[model samples]
Target chain A: MSPELARFLQDCEQDFQQALPALCQPPGSDCPAVPGGLAEAGAYSLGNGGKRIRPVLCHAAAAALGAADRTRSAAPAHALELIHTYSLIHDDLPAMDDDDLRRGQPSLHRAYDEATAILVGDGLQARAFEVIAGSDVLDAAQKVAMIGVLARASGMQGMVGGQYIDIHATGTDMDLAALQAMHQLKTGALIRAALALGGIAAGASEAQLRALDDYGRHIGLAFQVVDDILDVDGDPSALGKTGGKDAAANKPTYVKLLGLDGARQEAQQLLQAALTALETFGASADRLRELARYIVERDR
Target chain B: MSPELARFLQDCEQDFQQALPALCQPPGSDCPAVPGGLAEAGAYSLGNGGKRIRPVLCHAAAAALGAADRTRSAAPAHALELIHTYSLIHDDLPAMDDDDLRRGQPSLHRAYDEATAILVGDGLQARAFEVIAGSDVLDAAQKVAMIGVLARASGMQGMVGGQYIDIHATGTDMDLAALQAMHQLKTGALIRAALALGGIAAGASEAQLRALDDYGRHIGLAFQVVDDILDVDGDPSALGKTGGKDAAANKPTYVKLLGLDGARQEAQQLLQAALTALETFGASADRLRELARYIVERDR
Candidate 1:
């Protein structure tokens, strides 16, 4: 990884950490005390040290679009992370993936109670849209556009729909087409929204937005493909969660259908396609390009 | 009920029912098939027969503000219902309220499964914001403003936070202030948002909006106080769900805090206050006034 890309990610992490606690809290002086300590539980899951890939991608996309202030991307960046964290919290419930661990710590449900986990997840999702709608850095049009993108990506037709397909497909045979379709919605939609949100925040032209969408689609799938690969071989300690659970659960995956070498080749081709999509932006898109490479190459 | 208010509510219910099925489905032709039938599960809960109180409040508020076309309020009205339905679904989870029934039918988790219930709730919340953000009826500013109101009202500090407090306060002692505060958030916030959303849709002036908010707060508390009163003596058949569950669960309630007759008197007082709040609007707020009285007097 380039030092510049690493530094950019580091900065995003710092900014995100600073902004996160407030996101979980109710805004304004009239905030009622949540005697249940909901904010703490929300912060616990949100503050867990994930890679912050979505936020980094958002910031990079804005910078790539030549936004005068990359901080304009902060609202969407944080919103994406909140949405991602909420999905993780719900996914870890006993009725969902049933995982008891996440991000090297007890899952929100395991750490807190199941009820608190559920409310925290619900609160986080609401907070995501609230933050975007309330962002001072964004105009009304921009806020509406970003909210549209984020909502569609995270809604029934997007992440939640994908999850619906995945949970049902467990222990069932699924073709590569089926696998791709599920991942596209479950994981790809939000990833695509991240870039689109960043572009919207930066006031990118419609054409630029389309180009970012293309780049996002390719890398989104590539990210999932690489995730399948890592699940098969990545160290559990490094991954910070159980690995190979997919295979154990008999869920279909790119690695299972395409073979390890084939999945690797697919990811490489996707990386190439993602770079091609960014060609129109020239040097301004360097961060996006590096981030795409990092997405596929990173172990965790 | 006045014929005018009844007809207005009927129209709102019809509009909401017609728009609801589509909300659960993905928009656009490229939608992937969700084999888990998530859309159906979402539609089931949404389609269930509820009082449509929030949407009615919204439409009434809009009408009171003299919107030329009541349909202009559809997006926010539907969004409010979606948010309300989502909360009910989550609140019924085994980890939360653990009820097996809602609206005279099996609760979402009971009807489908826990995972699907959680996902549908999550999806509904996302779709609420999505519909508002993507509404053609509302301008960008209106959409942004409505999103802000809805998101804040339904968020951590609002409904979810209130639920957090209610769940924790179960089987414990809570004073009148604590009970009011909890009810204000859990139920009052959304009720207030419903009115605010309607007011915004109608382009209400600041003072008019404040009047609607004040009206909402009084009736919002009245609604809950009556709920506690009904829970103590209302028929399960009329209520369409188990009754007396609050006392059975030892959850804090107005009845417990204020006594039955006291709670009924409190509802009457709140109803009067709510009516006073709308005095400035005169006959224009007749629907709202009737609704407030209905809220306090209704058997359900």
Candidate 2:
């Protein structure tokens, strides 16, 4: 990996970790230090280490729009990661995936009781929008627009809607088109929202927002495709999660339908499509281009 | 009931029911109608008959502020009710209260599976914020502020925090102070937000907002006190829910600390305090004063 790219990711991770706890804590000093188990449960799920991909994407989109100050993007970046973390917590519930593990550790429901885990996910979801609503950096209009985008993506029409389709589709044969549509809502919508939020925060134009969204859709699907491939072939320790559980659960995947070679070829094509969406921008878009390749190539 | 107040409440209920379904459905025409079980579960829990007091309170607060158009407050009023419904659904989960009935029907988790109920609660929550963020009537700044208020009230420091305390406090004795604190967060926060949101929609002055909040806190406490009184003496069918369940579960209540007569006396005192908070306003606040009395006097 290039040093500059690696440094950029590291910085994003640091900012995400630092800003997240403050979001969950109460605003006034007189309030109790942590508010007990609900706060603890939220913090535990968020603090578990994972790839800070969404926040990095948000920062990258803002940088591409020529936003000079990284701090300006911090709230949206953290908010995206919070939303991502909350989804992971809910998706791993016993009633949902019934998974016992995530990020190479016991999942939130496993670490805490199912009730605590549920509240944690709900609280985190609320906190995500709260962060954006209370943001000092963005103007009111920008914050409102970002709120609309993020909520739609995370709510029914986006991630939650996708999840509803997915759980029902499990153990059933689905064509590529149905699978793609499901992923677009469940996984793709948030990825697209992350980019749009960054662009919105940076004051990007309507055309620029459209371009970022186009770039996001391709990478979003590619990300899920690579995830399927890793479940079959990647090392569990490196991946930081139990591998091959998707197939064991009889869930349909790109790897299952397309085979290894076809899935790899599809990933490359999607990566190219993503990079093409960023072509109008100059050197400022180099990070986004690199991220597209990374989505398909990351072993974990 | 006074004829004027009765008419006002009827109008608020109509607006709430009409606007709520539109909030759950997707925006674009292309998306599938109703989005299947998750959406169904959300609609089912939300559609069940209730008093619609929160939305009525919202409209009352707005009307008091001299807002000429009732239509302008519809979105915020409906959004507040959605948040209230979502909380009730989650609070009745098997892992939480383990209740079997709500609004005279099987509770959400009983009517649907536990998983569906969980998702329904989560989805409705996201929809609540989406309604505010997407409201065309309010300006972007107003929307942002409303979002912040609702999110904070529904989040860990508010409803969820109260639930956490209530669950832990069950089967244990509690003093009046602890009981008040729990009820304030659990029930009072959202009630307070409802009035504040209405005032905000009407562009109320800071002092007016403070007055509404003070009134909300008093009436919120009074509502719970009256609830405790009814649990012991009221008929279950009339209440549209299982009454006396709080005592059955060994849950803390004002009646548990104060005697039944004392609890009733406290309710009356709280009603006076609520009415006193609106002294600065003239007859415009008559609905609010009557609502406060009804909270203490209602049989069910």
| Top candidate by TM-score | 1
Cα lDDT tens digits, model 2, A79-138, are: 888888988888888778887888878998889887788777788888888889988878
Model 2 over residues B14-91: C-alpha lDDT tens digits?
766666766677667734343577777777877784888788888889988888767667778887888888888878
**Residue A191 error for model 1, in Å?**
0.4
Error of 1 at A274 (Å): 0.8
Q: Model-by-model lDDT, in order?
A: 0.90, 0.85
Over B182-206, each residue of candidate 1 has an lDDT whose tens digit, in order, gives: 9999999999999999999999999
Give Cα distance to truth, residue A33, candidate 2, Å: 7.0
How many pairs of residues collide in each model?
0, 0
Each candidate's DockQ: 0.75, 0.61
Error of 1 at B194 (Å): 0.4
Q: What CAPRI-style quality would you assign to candidate 1?
A: medium
User: Where is model 1 more than 4 Å wrong at Cα?
Assistant: A31-36, B30-36
Q: Candidate 2's error at B14, in angstroms? A: 1.9
